[model samples]
Structure formats: structure tokens, C-alpha cells
Target chain A: MDAMQIANSIPMWVACGIPVCLIIFQSLLFMSKARQASKDIGLSDDTVKKAIRASAITSIGPSLVILSGMLSLLVTVGGPVGWMRLSLIGSVMFEGIAAGIGTQQVGVTLGADPMTPTALAMAVWTMVLCSIGWVIFATFSASRMEKIQHKITGGSTKRMGIISGAAIVACFSSFVASHLIKANADVGFYFSKNAVAAILGALFMFIMMKISAKHKKLSEWNLTIAMVAAMILTAILPIGA
Target chain B: MNKEQKTEYFENTYMPKMHRYGKLIGVIGVLVSFIPPIVLAVVFKAIPDWGKLPAAFLTGAAAFGFLWIMEPIGYFNILGPVGTYMAFLSGNISNMRVPCSSMAQVSAGVEPGTEEGSLIATIGMAVSVLINVTILTIGVILGTVVLSKLPAGVVGALNYLLPALFGALLMQFGIKDIKYAIGMLLYCCVLYVLIYLGVFSWLPSAANWLPIITAVFGGIAFKLIVDSKKDKAAAAAEKKDE
Candidate 1:
């Protein structure tokens, strides 16, 4: 099938929806859990829930907006003749951006070989990457806490989820506007796939953290070990190998 | 927790040993991760089909083995199969194979290896690279699913997630050191300027290094300029008062 036909397939809808649901679910999941955890830890449920929701909402807008922005990315790149070149351009642009930061490190820069193809050969692998990042963020947050100052008022779990979800759809739309109209470039895969997967994987990571917190499954120790092992593997591997 | 209580909690309750153990294992794990590619590159470099298999398989096995071993030793509580699989997937990325020391520098929460934290830094980079690869993989899978549903043009939009995600990830990381963050912002800025100015078509290693080097010194430069100016202004005011 042609590229246009491939873009709007059934599976795509399902994939998109899953992350949407999950993001919505995450606001609720964390709000409730934080509320419950706060109550268990002897903090007031109402207060903790409100604060958590408030903190989370700050991030919701940006996350959703960034994600939705991906939808229209393809249209902006123009028809198929240039998609590969654009994708290539994007690959280098992003890779250079990614590898060039922070320090004079010789890691990713030395190994990165950007693909000028319509698709990154091993590009699908990035979802797992984004997911792992989500995991790290979630796990770290779960384990660490700042003194919760209950300032946000009336931010309930249900309300927060709806607001975040609505905001996400809107933000996502705004971000995707260029792609939607341009009909040339696409958000490509980065917006639709990695962001969704990252949010979902991270939200789901609550289960992992909860279990660990309760001392049932993973402990801090295992996290360290796994972290080290994963670190080692990626170091010697090729870019997106 | 109160300040004292918090300090005590970190000191006693959290177990410093865990972090040290993490660092130690991380170094070894990162070291182990380097093996498959070298081995494969050496022994079976000629085989076409065998090319990806050894790298993929051996790396997967090594990642899992390292994680599994460290999990119990370090008393980690995690998702049983999920963590293993995740690590397995991450351990196998092409980018991770390049021996890039840059991964540690990329992750903010994780410190890069210098003299003090070298081992831990190495471990952290490995993990971060694997995670990046894994997340990218998931994004592509889900993105393609969307692609399959939509027309080809729409499907192409799915590719934008990496930069989007990277942007978000970097933003999150930059929160740690706002001043240092200029380096990243400048990286994008310099690249654009160079490209726009027609200084070069592609970034030479020099183009990349120059901005970052400036940014690195830029931090020190910023502070020095401000301090020196402040000192001069203060001395002038003092002289006038006298």
C-alpha cells in the first residue's frame, strides 16, 4: 500500500488510543496512589491528592502538546519524494543534537550513524528506549519525595484526569497542526509511538514501584544491578542496535 | 520528614551500600556489554546473515545475565519478566555498541565517570542507551500501527516522536542544572546558525565541538564577566563615596 494508506490504518488508531487512555489513566493512577499512599503514610488524603494532581498537571500540557504535535509532522515534510531526505535530515539534526550535549563525551557521537532512509532501519527500537526512560522517571519519583505542601485546592483524581486528558488532546492537536495542514511532513514515529509508549510504560511502572515499596518484587538493589547491566550493554552496542 | 530525620533516613534507612553496589555492578555490566560485538566482529565478521544475530543474541543474553545477577545481590524488587525483557532489548541497540562514553554525560540523574564515579558512570550510560533504544523501538511499533491505519502520508508523521520525546527528556534533565542547560540549547542554536549561515552543509566535528566548548567555558565565562563587572562597578561607587 501507499504511504497515505499506511498512515491511517486500524492498528494505528488502536496504538494512538492506548497511549491516550494510559495518559488519562496515569493522572488518575498517580493521584489516587499518591492520595492513598499519603493517607497510609499519615498525610491527609485530600491534601496529598490535590498537590499531586497540581504537580502532574504542570507536566500534562507539555507532554500532550508535544505528543499531538507529531500527528501532523508527515504532512509538513511534503510528498514521498522528499520524506526520506527530510527523515535523513531529521535523523542527523536530532542525533547531532542528542549526542552533542552536556560534555565532551565520546560515547554516542563516535558511534552514531544517522540513517537517511524513509525509516530508521532499527528505529522501532526507540519506543522501548522511551519506555525505559519513563520507567526511570517513574521509579525515581516513586522512591523520592519532597515535603508535600498542600497548596492546590479541589484537584480531585477524576477531575484531574479529565482535565489532563482534554488538555492533552488539545495540546497534542496544536502541536500536530503543522503536520495536519502541510500534508508533507509527519510527526513521523517519534511523536505517536515513543511518547505514548513512554507514558504508558511509566504509568504501568507504578506496579513495579508499588511492589518494590512493599518489598514484594523489585528492591533498590535489583534496580541498581539491572541499571548497571543495561548500562553496560548499551555502551558497547551500536546506535539503536 | 524533618531535616534531621530526612538526613538520618537517607543515612540509615536507604542503605548507601545499595548505591555503591549499583556502581560496582554497573561497571562490570557495562564492561560485559562490550563483549558480543567485539567477539562477533572478530570471529564471524565475514558471515552476512550471522552479522546481526550474534550482536543481538549475545547482547540480550549478557544484559539479562548482568541484570539478573545484580538483582538478587542488590536486593532489588522489580517486575519479574518485564525488567529482564526490557534490559534485554536495551542491551542490543546499535548505538550502544559504539563504545561511546557520552551516555553518562547525557543522563542527568546519573553521574558520568570521571575519576570518582567512572565505574558508576559507565554503568549508567549503558543503561541509558539501552533504554533509549528500547523506547524508540516501542515508539516505532506503536507508530507503525498508526501508520498502518492511516494513509502513507499520515504514517510518516509517526516518526517525529523521537525528537519530541528527546526534547521532553532533555527538558526534564535540564531542570537539574539550568546554567549548564545552555550547552544543550546552544547545541541546537549553533547547528542552526551554522546551517543557516551556510558555514557548512553538515556539522563537522569542529562545528559540534566549538559551541559546546564555548558553552562549557561559557558557564565559567558568564560568571567571570559578571563578577569582574560587578567588582568594577562596586569599586567605582566606593571611590565616589570616598
Candidate 2:
């Protein structure tokens, strides 16, 4: 069979699925362990369930984005590789660039032509080697990070909370600010749909939090409501255009 | 078990299990990650020549090598230990995992970096993984047929969804302390402005790094300022009491 055939074959799909299965298994294992730990620690089931609900709700938007990215990749590498990679690693940009380089090395462009088996092999090796660093580092040092946080906070849980909160704010502000900065570049009454959507999203969330304070079920849906509201608003407004 | 022993058991007993699972997953993940390509190459007998290997690996690594180390270092605190293991394997740490963990902790009303917060974060991450995998599996199975039928405008709108979620996420955390959120936002804007004006032209790579640079430095500076003010206030109160 040709490169495309192999990439799309059932065997290739199964091979790709092995790691995905491993990921699911590991996540299930960790989830069970965490649930038990939380119980042992006397953590209320209500809180745990709330977290699960909120996280699962919050994930839908981002997962859709990944799905979109996966479809584009499907055109380049066949269905199985794209599905497996996006399902497991879920780094679309890195995988796309790596695959491009693989094709480039063989004097063939990735989407432009059929990939040779040699080109496919190189792509796999490159993507694996480049992305392995995270697993390696996390394996050795994941446990040590709490100590580092401890030292930073001087054993103060309050201070640790502040630091964690600040780090999160800083990290997210960078992305939001980048979009806002670009939106503000026009200097007039002009705004990009992205910036408007972002503002609307935050605004919607703020409102949700206010309502949820009095009526608690709203908290679980805060992320979903905000995201969907912003997306719908962007579609209807024509503000960015 | 009581609180102290629970903490000890978690750290002593649960933590070792986490490490064990982490390493097992990591090793198995690394080995299995190579299967798709390895199997294809073997089936077709399409292994590339040895001479071209180094360049192939280096070319891809060069693009993202920095993030491989920096992401773990940068995000470790937010994710904690168990979250970290799952996040690296699942990917999308910044966009998905961090938000999930933070939201989980906040909703649970637990302070991050504590045992309760760590367990909650791990649970949040694992749920997210399961949800994501389920959706993607369905999408992959039926993606081309379904997605192809959707309007381009609708699909285009989907792109804005992530940015929207990010904005919402910021608000979720920012509501706890509006002052710090505003401060960090302003700092990020300044970095963006400086880069936009070509002030950092000589350091071209700094533009791409503007966010992270701003985050680390801005967070530290802001923390120091806040701490010093607290100290001053405490001292003044003490003197008044004296």
C-alpha cells in the first residue's frame, strides 16, 4: 500500500490508538485516586462534584477548537494519525510544523503531495523527540514543585494562594492583553470581533458570578454561558467587520 | 485519619503512588508515542536514512525546545504534581488545564498549593481529559462529513470561542482580587505597546516572549510591592498599639 493507504489503514489507526488508550487509562486511574484521596481528606462530595461539573463544562469550547484544528490536520496526514495525535498530544501547531519539516527534508511539501514512507517516518521521529522533553521533565521534577512553592511562600498558605493567583492572572492577562492591544491599534471607534467577544465574555462571566452568588446553580454554567454568549454575539454583531 | 495524619498520608503514601503512576505513564507514553510512525515505517519499509536524522530532529526541536522546559517550570505551581503529569501527557496546558485546575480550586473554595487543592486540581484535569477525548473521538469519526456541511461563517465564529473562554477565565480569577488583575492587565498592555512600536526591534524574539516576560517580571514586582505595603501597614498598626 501507498503512504496514504498506510496512514489511513485500520492497523495504523489501532497503533495510533494505543497511546490514546493509555492516556484514558491513566486519567481514569488518577481520577479514582484523587476521588479516594479527597474522601480520605474529608473533602465534601459536593465540592468535588462541582469541580467536575465546572471543568467538564469549561472544556467544551477549547475541545471544539482542538477539533477544528484536527480537521485541518486530517487533510495533511490521513485520518488516523491526525485523530490520534490530536486526541493524545493535542498540540496542533507543533505537529503541523513538524510534519511540514518532515516533508521538507524529502523535498516534498506536506499538503501539496502524497507523502513518501520515508517522509512519514521522519515526521514521526521529529515530533516524538521534540515533544518528549515535557514528559521527561515532569517525570523527574513534578513532585519537587511543591517544595519550590513552599520556599517561595515561606510556608504561608495565604501567601502561596496569592502567588498562585497572581501567576494565573499574569499568564492569562498576556493572551487577553495581546488581543486587546491589537484591537486598540486602530485608534478610532474600531474594534475587532475578537476583542469585543473577549469583553462580552468577561462581562457575561461577571454577571453570572453575581447571579450565582444568590442562586448557586448558575456557577456551574458560568463558563459555558459566557463562551456561548460571546460566540453568538460575534456572529450577530458585525462589529469587527 | 485526622488532619495532620491525613496530610502525612497524602504526602507519604499518596504522593509516592502519584510519582509511580507518573513515571509509568511517562515511560509508556514515550514508548507508545512513537508507535504510529514506527509501525507505518516498518510496514512500508520507509525508514529514512541515518544521515538525515539529526537535522530532522533538530529542525523541529529548535522551534519549541524552549517551551518544553519553560512550560513545566512556569506552570508547575498552578498544576501541582498530579495535574502536571496528566497535563504534559494530554497537552494544551495553558489554555485548558490551567483554567480547569484554577476553576476547580476556586469553586471548591480551597487555597491552591494545599493537599485539598491538589486533589481537586487532579480531579478537574482528569475529567477534562475524559471530556476532551470523548469529543475528539466522536469528531474524528464523523468530522469530515459533519464539518464539511457546516457554514464557513459558523466555523469561523468557532475560532473566537477560545479567546472568549480565556477572557471569561481571567474574570473568574480576577473577581477575587480586582486590583491585581487590573495591574497585570496594564502591565501586559505596556509590553504589547512597546513591541508594537518597534522598541524591541533589536530583540526580535522578545516580541513573541512579551507575555511570559511580562508575566514573570510583572508578577514578582507586583508581589513585592504588595508585600512591602502590607509590612508597612502592620508596622504602623503596631506602633499605634505601643
Candidate 3:
């Protein structure tokens, strides 16, 4: 069979489904355990329910973004593999890059050259092996993170809080900065629609938070409203165009 | 439960159980990841060149190895333990899981570093995972049909979703400390410009990680210095009172 046929085959679907099922199972299991633990620790049911609602609502936009990304993956790698990888341990960019590298190793350029079964196999192998590092590291090192946290903050909860807040701000700022700046091959650097979107997103969120302070119910929808407003404004503007 | 008892339960019972289960599931995930490729080779008789396997592995590893170590460490403080496990396994860490976790904490009115925060973060992450997978499954099955029907502008706007999400999250965290938020944002922009100018060309993959490393550690260092200065001022006030 050809690459696409093999990629969309029943065995392929079943093979890919196993990992996706595992992820769902793990999420459900952890959710149940955490729910029980939250009760034991005296977190209000209202708080837990609100978190669930907020997170679920917040996930929709990004999940749609991932869906768009998956369209590219689907065309190149076929449905089953793309579905499985994205559902499990691969981002859209990483998966595309890894697939390209894999095909390149077998003397082919992904999307540029027609895929052969051998090339597909190489792509799958590279994707899996490339992702293994994160799983293994996180598995072994996750339990030990508290010790590192303790050492960093000198065992003071107050210091720990400060550091944690700083780290979060820094990490996200880095993400925003990267998005805001566009590097062109000919030009050095310039601001683009992404920057506009980010700025607008922050502005909208700030306003939303202010409004939510009084409305209360609006807080749960703050992120969704901010994101949609920013995206719409960025799209309508002709800054980058 | 009282504060001490709650802390004790989280550290002693809940955390330990999560760790054990997380490790087990992680191992299983790693092993299961190879199934599709194995199935391709064995069932479909599609086999890659054996000699090239190592080169391919090395190529991928070289490109992404640093992220494997850096991301887990960088995201740990925000994600906490259980969220980390779910996030790494489920992917979309920065875009989907982190924002969801942060928003959950915000809506729940919990501080990010506390045990209560961690539990809320886990619930947030789990909820996102469930919704994300469900959406993905349905999208995959119907993507071609639905996506083709959508306006090109709408599809194009999807790219901005991530930046918008990041921007919103930055504001979410930044509002707590505006000075650090602006400082870190500027710091990252400078680093990105430096990277674009090839100042860090001597380092491999400098563009990918330099901003992150500097921002994260730099923020931590800045906080430590500020806190120490505050402590010193408090101590001086106490001395004066004495």
C-alpha cells in the first residue's frame, strides 16, 4: 500500500487510538482525584465548579487554533497520526518540524516531495523519539521539583510566592515579546499584526477585569471576551497588510 | 480543615499519590507512543532505513533536546506537579494548558503558589485536556469539510489566537506587579532583538531559548534583590524601634 493508505489504515487508527485513549483516561483519573483532594483541603464546591467552567470555556479558542494547525498535519501525515500526536504529546509546530526532519533523513523534503511508506515510517519514528525526552524527564523529575522549589525560596512560603509570581510573569512576557516582534529575512525586525493583537488582547483583558470587578459574573468570561475582541480587532485592522 | 492540616494533607497524601500515578502513566505513555510506528513496520511492511535511524534521532534530539529540559523546569512553578504531568502528556502547554490553569486560579480567587492553587490548577488543566481532546477528535473527523466552508479571513485570524491568549495572560499576571511585568517584557524584547542581530550566534539555538532563560532567571533574581532590600528596610525600622 502507498503512504496515505497505510497511514489511514485500520491498524494505524487502532495504534494511534491507544495513546489518545490513554491521555483521556489519565485526565479523567487525575480530575477525579483532584476533586476529592480539593474537598479534603476545604476548597469550596463553588470555587471548583467555577474553575471547571472557566477552564472549559477558555479552552475552546485555543483548541480551535490547534484544529487549524491539525489541518496541515492531516494533509501531510494523514488523519490517524495527526489526531493522535496532537491529542497527545506534540504541538503543531513541533510535529511539522519533526516530520520534516524525519523525511529529510530519508532523502526527501516533506510536502515538497511525495511521501513514501519508508519516509512515513521515518517521520513517525523521529516524532516519537524526539518527544520521549519530555515524557521521561517530566516523569522522573516532577516529584523532585518541590525540593528545588524549597531550595530556591530558602524554605519561606512568602519568598516562594514572590519567585513563583516572577517566574510566571517572565515566562509569559517572553512569549508575548516573541509574538510581538517579527523578524524578516531582509529587514532586521518590525512590529506586525501579532503585536497589535497582543497589545489589544492585554488592553481588552484589562478592561474586562475592571468591568468584572463590579459585574462578578463577567470574570468567568473575561479571557474569552478579551481573546475574541483582540482577534477581531487585529483582523479588521490593516496594519500588517 | 485548618491551614496546617490542609498543607500536611496536600504534601503528604495528595502530592505523593499524584506523583506515583503520574510516573506510572508517563511510562505507559512513552511506551504507547511507539505503537503506531511499530504497527507501520510490522503490519504494513513499511520500514525506514535502519542505518539512518540514529541520524534522524540525533537530528530531532539536537533540535529539541534543550526544550525537553527547559520547558518542564520553566513551566513547573505555574503548572505545579499534577498539571505538569497532564500538560506534558497532552501537549499545548503554553497556549492551552497554562492559560486555562491561570484563568481557573483567577476565577477561583486562589494564589498561584499555594496548595489550593495547585489543586485548582490541576482541575483547570484536566478540564482543558478533556475539552481539547474532544474538540480535536471532532475537528479531525469533520475538519476538512468545515474548514473548507469557513471564510478565509476567519481561518487566517486563527493564527492570532495564540498571541492574543499570551497577551491576555501576561496582563493577568502582570497586573499583580506592573513594574516586573513591564521590565520583563522589555527585557525579553531586547533579548529578541539581540538574537535577531545574531549577537548570540555563537550559541546553538540561541534564538529559541535565550530570551526564556534570561527572562525567567532574571525575573527571579530581580525579585530576590527587591525582597532583600525590603527586608533590610524592615530590619532597620525594628532596630530604630529598639
TM-scores of the candidates are 0.29, 0.92, 0.97
Task: Write out the backbone clash pairs for model 3.
Answer: none
Model 3 agreement with the true structure over A18-58: per-residue lDDT tens digits: 99999999999999999999999888899999999999999
Winner by TM-score: 3
Rank ordering of all candidates by TM-score, starting from the highest: 3, 2, 1
Give the per-residue lDDT of model 1 (tens digit) for B184-226.
Answer: 4544354435544557644333332333333333333444455
Best by lDDT: 3
Q: Candidate 1: how many backbone clashes?
A: 113
Error of 1 at B236 (Å): 16
Residue-level lDDT for A217 in candidate 1: 28
Best by DockQ: 3
**C-alpha RMSD of candidate 1:** 19.1
Can you tell me the CAPRI class of model 1? Answer: incorrect
Better of 2 and 3 by DockQ: 3
Estimate every model's Cα lDDT from 0 to 1: 0.29, 0.78, 0.88
